[model samples]
Target: MTTSRTYEDLVKEAVDASVDGWDFSWFEGRATEERPPWGYARSMAERLAVASAALDVQTGGGEVLASAPSLPPLTAATEGWPPNVAKATALLHPRGAVVVASPEDASLPFAEGAFDLVTSRHPVRTYWPEIARVLRPGGTYFSQQVGPASAVEVVEYFLGPQPPEVRDARDPERARARAEEAGLEVTGLQEARLRMEFHDIGAVVHFLRKVIWMVPDFTVDRYEPQLRSLHARIESEGPFVAYSTRFLIEARKPGR
Candidate 1:
């Protein structure tokens, strides 16, 4: 006799099937790679070590924790993440890292004055306020984010055949204002633009879907019509360049 499966089991199977079909990299070989390094991981770890007491906000994939396991003990939390991610993170940080499944815009699980250094990369915009709220006075907050420039290929592939209005590091004033509003004094900012190469447009599309974390609102399904037009355009225009903009900004909370 066959046993009946629960609704949860069916949903889990569906989700797992989708994930398995996608050729996504879990970065299992992170420990072996030599060149380029994980810049965001190493850099954020360094800044946190400087602050003494630190928190890694939304520690997805645990790469940052893996990068700096020897640094000062760190508290790790990932807003609205699954237990699997938390479990993986624990492998790198056994003692202090704890996962929180709450949305990043809402109140965090940790108490006030919980940390002196807060490091985040590629977190949703709503999480910034919560990040500001959790750091100790006179603390440092460092975030390396994939800026609007990251959507270049997607915009070109889809989005009505025209480029989206994306401003680069030239918009320093706006960047400073944003950090200040988060209750942090802006210190330094840098934008590193890199051209990601793809063998063909199909490869570009695959990378966008799997590795890039394209905004949920602008998924491949939503942009399929435009993507077809984009594919045609690329066939006519030849190889294309995907521009990725990496922004590194450091800020400090005011001391009493």
Candidate 2:
């Protein structure tokens, strides 16, 4: 289907596409990425069904938490973006989860040792001290994080080869050390390298626009030459291939 489309047509279609929610349904036929083996949402739901209190951090549009079959009696979620906050509130309130507007890197607004469980999916940054402070003595923090060198192909394609620091930013070992330093014991950690394929330039444009941090300041007008070149490559060679790294980490507070 993409082979029959023009670059301008595809780019315009992607640019006009609305990235209203957290789900990747928009990339249905244009692109595809392998899912991590761990079914994070289902796993989180199993835990939430038994917990007395729980909190979800950086809940974009409340998509994942809202999918839970059962929620804790006391459930809350935090989101930094105003638009996402409103969206999350709307989606979560019916499920009995209150949404709070809080920055991802800032201290959580809840009282210390408030929640029995905390969760986040692909949080841009995790503040270990703050996470530890908000959890009860025996509470757990479970998250699926974007691991180091994730989608490096896309990043390098646009901004050349990056330094080792940039490539190693979200190291799982560093996360484990930080959690341990904050008085939490690391329980489980698993990682996966997922294959990603972009069938056309439109999907690439939409992806970069949705995941803004991938390019920081991505603009079609500014990156037209690169986009055009990439479009030509895809047209002649086939779907552009890339890999995304992800990790699942679980940490628990001691002193039960």
Candidate 3:
């Protein structure tokens, strides 16, 4: 008897794949997501050009920072994951940037007023007080964050309906309030809900693996039933449609 390739096989393959360094290129044709109207990379590049010193928190592989046309004289990035720290160091060292391995919740290692600009893309969680402490007077903190209920459709597929409070946990307004409390003046805020599509079960598995927060405690064994159901739905319904929410926020410390 010959065994046919099943959804379980596809999911297992994805689960075993590497999920390091925040790169999403593996999903090229398997999945797609709309970009925000305001280009985050472009905006970050523009800001990078003028700042004298900068820090990027949670710099996953330093891919985005390395793409900037030019970096400031002194630039540093922090990564909580060791794999990402090594990857970021290898990628950024050539660009004259330092990559520090730090825990996500630990205090920033740099001294007070060390950087004129601080940035992050999809940071796990923003440490507002630490950001304020590291930024010089008049320094800016710019980031593109995952907003409330981001990718809820995908999350709900595995876990069922989430409570309103759980869905609203990452609300932009709450973030703004925190920033204010940290003594940073909110300068710019923008939010967008972008379309996302998963063409195959493998793509969904890969995504859940890479973005662990999307479906906390996800495992091929644990979610096999749900994954199989989703695979069947995709086979019959074309693709799995979901929405991702993103927010761009810029906060500035007082004084020149």
**Residue range 63-176, candidate 3, lDDT tens digits:** 999999999999999999999999999999999999999999999999999999999999999999999999999999999999999999999988899999989988999999
Candidate 3 stretches greater than 4 Å from native: 1-9
Give one digit per residue, the lDDT tens place, for model 1 in 1-256.
1114432342233334323211234323211122222377677766656666777666565565556745555566564556436554555446556655566566777777778887776665535566677878888788776665564655555543443344343244566687788887988787666655443334444454444345335544565565555555545675455666667778888895
- RMSD list, candidates in order: 8.9, 1.0, 2.7
Q: Candidate 1 regions off by >4 Å? A: 1-38, 83-87, 93-95, 161-172, 211-239
Q: Provide the lDDT at 29 for model 2.
A: 88
Which residue pairs clash within candidate 1? Answer: none
Clashing pairs in 3: none
Q: What is the lDDT of residue 216 in candidate 3?
A: 84
lDDT of 2 at 189: 97
Candidates in order, TM-scores: namely: 0.69, 0.98, 0.96
Better of 1 and 3 by TM-score: 3
How many backbone clashes can be found in candidate 1? 0
User: Looking at model 3, which ten-residue stretch has the lowest summed lDDT?
Assistant: 1-10
Residues forming the 10-long window of minimal summed lDDT in candidate 1: 27-36
**What are the lDDT figures for the candidates, one per model?**
0.57, 0.94, 0.93
